[model samples]
Target: MGKKTTHKFKAEVSQLLDILVHSLYTNKEIFLRELISNASDALEKARFKGQAEGAEDTVAPEIRIACDADAGTLTITDTGVGMTRDELMRNIGTIAHSGTAELTRLAGEGKESLDALIGRFGVGFYSVYMVADEVEVTTRSIEPDAKPVVWTSDGRTDYKLQELDEDLPRGTKIVVRLKEDLASQFTNAAHLKHIVNKHSNFINFPIYVGDERVNTIQALWREPKFQITSEQYAEFYKFLTFDPDDPFDTLHTSVDAPVQFNALMFIPKHGDDPFGMGRENRGLDLYVRRVLIEKQNKDLLPEYLGFVKGVVDTEDLPLNISRETLQDNILMRKISSTLVKQVLDHLAKMAKDDADRYADFWRAHGELFKAGYMDFLNKDKFAGLVRFHSSGLEDEKGLTSFADYITRAKEDQKEIYYAYGPSREALNLSPHLEVFRRKGVEVLYLFEPIDEFVMDALSEFDGWSLVSAEHADPAKLDKFESLEAEDKPEPLSDTEKPVLDKLLARMKDALGDAVTEVKASARLSRSPVCLANPDGNVTSSMDKIMRVMSKDSSIPKKILEVNPDHPLVRNMLTILERDENDPFIEQAANQLYESALLLEGYLTDPHALVGRVQDLLTKSSGWYVASEK
Candidate 1:
């Protein structure tokens, strides 16, 4: 054995060490993940190089993890092109590897396009000491002529390397001497198995904990697209999502461009399960060239897509000071932005490729798309992926693209208009949509409840505004010539008009001034009346859901738009005229307003309307006895 020679870290490593030892990583056990990941990377590299030489022996396949608690040690070994003396000093001791130096040297070299050649380094190696009091590396190059070397570090300020002759093997072995307190973690085989399974289970290589293979997962990201069968993706989705249901949509892509990355992402068929359990999803995982970076990296996807499961492999992320503290990391941010763009772009293509399939995806995960549309922060991209049902399409409930909406728009139409209802049938009957249907104008039918806020978030798509069908002022039709005007519905007689007008004034008094200039409604066709928010602060759909769930929230003052045309309105007018002294007229007015609300998808007590209906029935029958009560 040679004398233990120690050398200090390069400035960056020294700065990085302070960060790692202090608070860069939230958990110390991630050291195992980092070291094991490096072993896997090296093993994969050896496998690639071995393929060049036609070496297919399983003996030197890739990676193996062995734990020795008696010595308080955990060893990760890889039969790779192990480091030579100069390579060890350059790679391990000084951080002067050609890859790092070349990156710095060529930094200003045209957009810093060194991504094709550069991968991560240094940090993943030093991370071992977070768990181990001491870390030792025994390595031998597969070169037939090169000798073996060992490197040792306590992760303080220095490390040492020397020539070594062990039970002669051509590979690299990392042995970690666990701190006395942490010894029990590796002492119990089950605990060690847990860490490996959680962090490194999908490592492309076979990882053995004692005699059993612990990492049985396939690194599906790197496999060729054609080679990955749907069965494989489905099986992988089960493991990835931990759900029994099949995927809602799966996107697997390999790109070699601005950077090299392999990614597999799946939109789960069921988010309600985990969400119902009150689980906060961690979003899609992050990886680097097939090595696990973090199993639940939130930054890899938006919060709305937190239920999705998959892996993103980028070879160029800096691994932070500790591989664990990757939030808001510079390279990670860039990668995340790029990933969002890619996912949105792919989804847009999917929608364009097959309308039926994409509509099915919309049916399965439309809320997520709406959420992304609202808050994804990638507006331009998300705008393309959104799908909706439009009355403009040929079939009932047939879907239309935003682009299709644009194309079908009137020559002078400067905005896209949509109406919200609980059902397409309901929308078709909505009093608010009367003029739109008469004018042959198309409206996107927003059946979803949250789409009101979602549209507010989206605001506009491709320079066209999103206008709500409910709140669009009929007076605003002054902007365009009335398409056609039929005779106004027969007005109540002058004698009856005063009573309705007087009653409407009283009803408006009961509702607030937010009701804005209420008169007999021109919009109603067959409906008695409908409630509308004139200011558009809340949609009727939103009001219904909130009132059902929240005790403190009062239903907003809704404008009662009554049909002077409908038979119910006519009867109310006649009753008001016949009995100016009758309290039943006022009760009918209140019930009519409330029933209008019910029609608008807002909740209402039917007993109140039913009681009023019976009141009128009893008054007409002249059965004002105890039987009426």
Candidate 2:
């Protein structure tokens, strides 16, 4: 053996080592994950080289971890492309290879250059000292004639290099003498197995602790889409999502040009919370070369895609020195943007290729998925993905997208009409949809509270504005001449106009500030009365949502449009003509306005409306008794 040589670590390296051992990492157990990950990378490099050189039989690449409690030692061995004597001196002995000085400079300058240091610097090996009192490494290069090299460090200011025994394998092995208290924890086979599985379960090669293999689960994300079976995907999805049913869709993608990554994402057949969970929690696991770096990483995917669960493996990620979290927000954003696009693209294709399966996805996650319609980055893309109950498809299961809506819209239709209500059933009964149904115009039924905000965010789709049915002006349809001449109420007859005017004036007086104006309705065909937001920009749905959030109980003034042809309004006109001061006429006018308010979901107190309704019923029942006598 050559004489052992000792080399002093650079001043900066020594300082970094002290910090890494005492305070750099939050969890001491992470030392095992870091070291094991490094070993996996080395083994991968060796395998690639062996394939190119046709020397595959030289050694079987595997990672074996052995713990000795009595000896206070934990050793990790891997058949990998080991470093030569000179390589060891430069890679570990000097600070240059580890980028210690650069890291220190960046840290002193603040975190602006953090990404540069974390992504380019290689200092994970030093983290072993966080738990170990001393660490020793034995390595032999793939070259047959190369001598084995051994490096030892007490993790202070210096390290020593010596030659290993000739019979040592052509790989690298690290032996750590754990600190007194940490020894027992590191030596426990079961404990170490857990750490391995938690951080490195999907590592390509087999990982063994003692004689038992721990990393049995395959990293399916790295595999080709063509080779994977649906059964395999279903099994993997169940494991990841904990959902017993099969996934509605699976998006497995591999990209290399801009940012290299492999993603295996799944849309579950059902969601844990269909509406929303009221928080942004990303279900995607972030991995580097198959070793999980962050599990359930919220930064990996956007909040809108919270329902998607899977793993994303990429070498392009820039991880901090601890390898616990990502350091590059710019790179992470790139990955997230790409993922959002890919996932949306897959959904769009699924929607087009298979309507039945797409409908299944819609039923499962559609409520939460509508959140994407407001995503600024993908609003237009999401426009095609959103599904809604429309006048054209009255069935609850028959949802129409904006694309279909545009296709079915009447010629020269400049706006896409939609109505917001408690549900499809409620929207079907809404007075606001009377004219839409009568004219054969399709209006989207928005059921959720968030749908209004989503529409406001989207504002427009495919060059057409999203106009709310409750806010749409009746005169806007006159140009389309969609309402047949017979369908249009004979424009207030010269003689009947005065009676209609009298009813409007009485209603306006009774409602006071409750209504901005009470007008004759050219839109209503079957309904007695309806409320419309005169300020077209604010839909009734939007107003209600704002009211709830701001805790504002005061109702905003709305235009009360009364259908002149309806029996209720015509009778009110006749009653008003007979006796303007009649108490029943006042009760009747107030009832009309309150009922409209209730239908618009703006009625704050139902108590008053209920009393008015009781009064009307009592008066009508008495009138019926008199008629019978």
Candidate 3:
């Protein structure tokens, strides 16, 4: 051995080493990932240089990992371009000095494949200290006349470097003496293989642990779309998500503008948490040059798109020293913007090409996808993808998109109407739908409580306001001729108008503050009464959801609109005229108010409603028996 020299680590490097050994990474196994990534980078550099120099190399590039359980030591060796004495001093002696980054800078545009290099921060090698008491690096450069060098360090204040007289192969080898507490965990070959498979399985180079080859999986996302087969995609999806069923659809995309990244995303056949019991773990596995940097990185996609799964590998992202967290959020947002666009574009194509398959996707993910209404930046795309069951459809299972609804809308229609109910059958019975049914207009049916929030967030689409059927303007609806041909029931005669007015006053008095207003409803044709939000500050569905969340059971006050032409309303007017203090008129009025509340899902007590129905039934039955006798 040549004369040895002792050198102190950079002041900042010493501080960084302390952090790396203690708390820089949440998982101790991350040390293995970082070291493997560095090795991959070096191999890539060597391959790029060989291509540039037109050199015919004979050796195959690979990484080898060996464990000595009894000795409590693990060794990793790579057949890649190694470092010289001066190069080692510059790369390892200083902090945050990346050889890969320097080579890229020096090569500039001459080396196109240098983008595959992974290590951007020089601190990755020091992470070995996280699991090792001491590290030894023995390397021989490919440069002619370059002697082998040995670097020894305890990862503390100082390290020793010496030149070796003997010739060695052109590559790098690192041996780690495991710390006492962590020795058993890392010294076994099986455990080391598991670590290699978890983090570096997709690395371009082959990896070996003893006689067995690990990292057998390919980075299929980096391959061209035309070269990949359907079977391969399905197999890869299963491996990535562990979902037994095939994916509903796959979105394999490569973007170049704004940022460059390759992504393989899948829309699962069914959501992992369809009921949303708790916050689901979401986001894609983020990779940098095929090395796993962050798993389930929520920052890569918005919460609404959490149902999507797969991997995203980008060279544009800047990682902090630990590589566990992202250094720049702006680049992440750019990548996210591109991803959202790609996903929406794929769905749009499916919707246009295969209606049945698109419908299946809607059924599987619509509940969660509807939340994308808040993504206003992609509002047009989101609107094009939303599907709803409409009054025009024959059944609840039938679906239509907003674009289709607009196409079917009447020429004079300016607002897209929707209504909320517990079910389609219940909505058919809604008093609020009488006018919409009469006008031959379609109304979207909102079943889930979140549907109300989605519509409210959207408010409008394709220049048409999304107005609730219950909140439709009476005057605008009157412009459309009634499609119903049979209408013989005359409105209250001119002389009886005063009686109707008195009945309205009496009913208002009976309901008291339960109603904001009680007036004749011109929009009603079949039902006697219906409720409306006077201020329109909150939709009835949202009101109920808020009430449930806040634990408030009181019914919300709303306007009560009575149809004058209905038989029940006409009879109530006669009863009020005969006896202004009649108890039956007050009871009937209260019953109508409670019935309307039930339709709005706000009625807290059904006992009073049940008793009123029974009272009316008893009186009617008694009259029927007397007539029969």
Candidate 4:
């Protein structure tokens, strides 16, 4: 046996211990996590040194944990590059060289770099004091002739170092005598296995709790992409996400400079709710050097990507002392920004290379992607992922993106036209689309109520303003001639214009506040009448959405357009010119306006419309009897 020396802890070491034992009371269970992480780090260093020295796997690297319920003790053993006597005394009893105090002071000052330095300072070993009253460490160096040493500390003020009586193996072992109150909490084999698997499951070396081995699965994210198989990837994804369906997409990448990170992310075949879920917090698991630091870490990704499931292992993340939360937010943002870009880039590639698969993904996740419409920083990129039912397509099976719309737009089409309705079928049948259909101009159909907000968020795509078809003026389509109507029809006769004007004015008077302005229709080639929003005003779809949201009963006014060529309107004009007060004339005019209101999806109370239709039928019966007699 060699001489035993008792040494006092550096002032900073004492101060740090004081905080761990008393001031910092949370995450006491993290002591196991910290110790396991330290063991893993030591194992990693030993493996690297063994490779450098051309040592041929002297002893298989592993970590073993044994819990002694009767003895009230927990011991962790690691076959790592053990430290020498001088190294142990300097590393355990002193903190001058590491300057943990300066790091703490700098952390208080909000110095970003010092936060990372603190993580690398190796002060995590002291966290054992949180659970144990006394700790003993026995170690022997890998050097052939170095003597073994034992270090003992109560983690209060000072520690003792002494040489072991006999030679020991090239590794370190720590035995912790738990406090009486804390003994029952941690001495169980099951609880220790849970902690080991929770935090250290990805450690490079095998970990054994008693005789059984834990941490069986490899950290595939840290491995090169080429080395993993599709079946393995699927299994890993199932393990991480508990999802049975194969992932629609996978993004595996490793970044070196600026930030060091390895990410293996998966987009599930379907999400929990593709539509809005009301700001639910969700994100990926975060790990540092194979040890999990935060599970479900929301800071690693924005809420827009909550549906994504995967793991992000980075060596550069600066963690707090407990490794529970991140320390440097600015650094986190940099990593997050890079991750977001990579994910988007991978999606863009999928969109470009695989239309069928991408379409499937889009059909499931398109609405969620719309949530990113307000993310100005990524709006342009996100726009490429937007899909909508288009008038140009015969069926709704295929969806068109804004980029596709721009490519197919007419040369003089100054605006990107879209129409919002409750469903694709409603938007398809909307009378507002008459002019576009006549002129062969395509209009995008938006179905969801939130689609309006999404369009407003994007505002414009490729320098072309997004104009709702319901709100578009007939004049906008004047540039494109109606392809079917090559020869224009005769205009309304000069003398008949007076009668048409009187009929329009009378119809406007009958409708009262409902009609903003009554005018001849240039848009309608088939329908008798239709309602449209006045120029520079909200579309009927927008009005309906607002009314429903606010629970308001009042409906907004819309311009009334009359097709003079239609037989119904011609008959009404004749009645107005002959006898403006004719009861049937008023009934016909009112019916015409109500039908337009119904078509616009704004007429909620059907009683008034039903009553008017019955009156018109009764009057028609009276007219038919008179004619038959």
Local error of candidate 2 at 445, Å? 0.7
Give the candidate number with the greatest TM-score: 3
lDDT of 3 by residue, 198-245 (tens): 889999999999989998888999999999998888999999888998
Off by over 4 Å in 2: 97-120, 164-166, 278-281, 318-329, 479-496
What TM-score does prediction 3 earn? 0.93
Q: What is the lDDT of residue 141 in candidate 2?
A: 87
lDDT of 4: 0.80
Deviation (Å) of 272 in candidate 3: 1.8
- Candidate whose lDDT is highest: 3
State the local distance difference test value for candidate 2. Answer: 0.80
RMSD of 2: 3.2
Tens digits of lDDT, candidate 1, 201-263: 777777777778888888888888899899899999888777887787888887666566778
> What lDDT tens digits, residue by residue, belong to model 2 across residues 385-484?
8888887885766988888899998887888998888877788888878878777788988878777777888889878999888777677775665455
lDDT of 4 at 118: 34
Clash list (residue pairs), candidate 1: none
Give the candidate order by descending TM-score: 3, 2, 4, 1
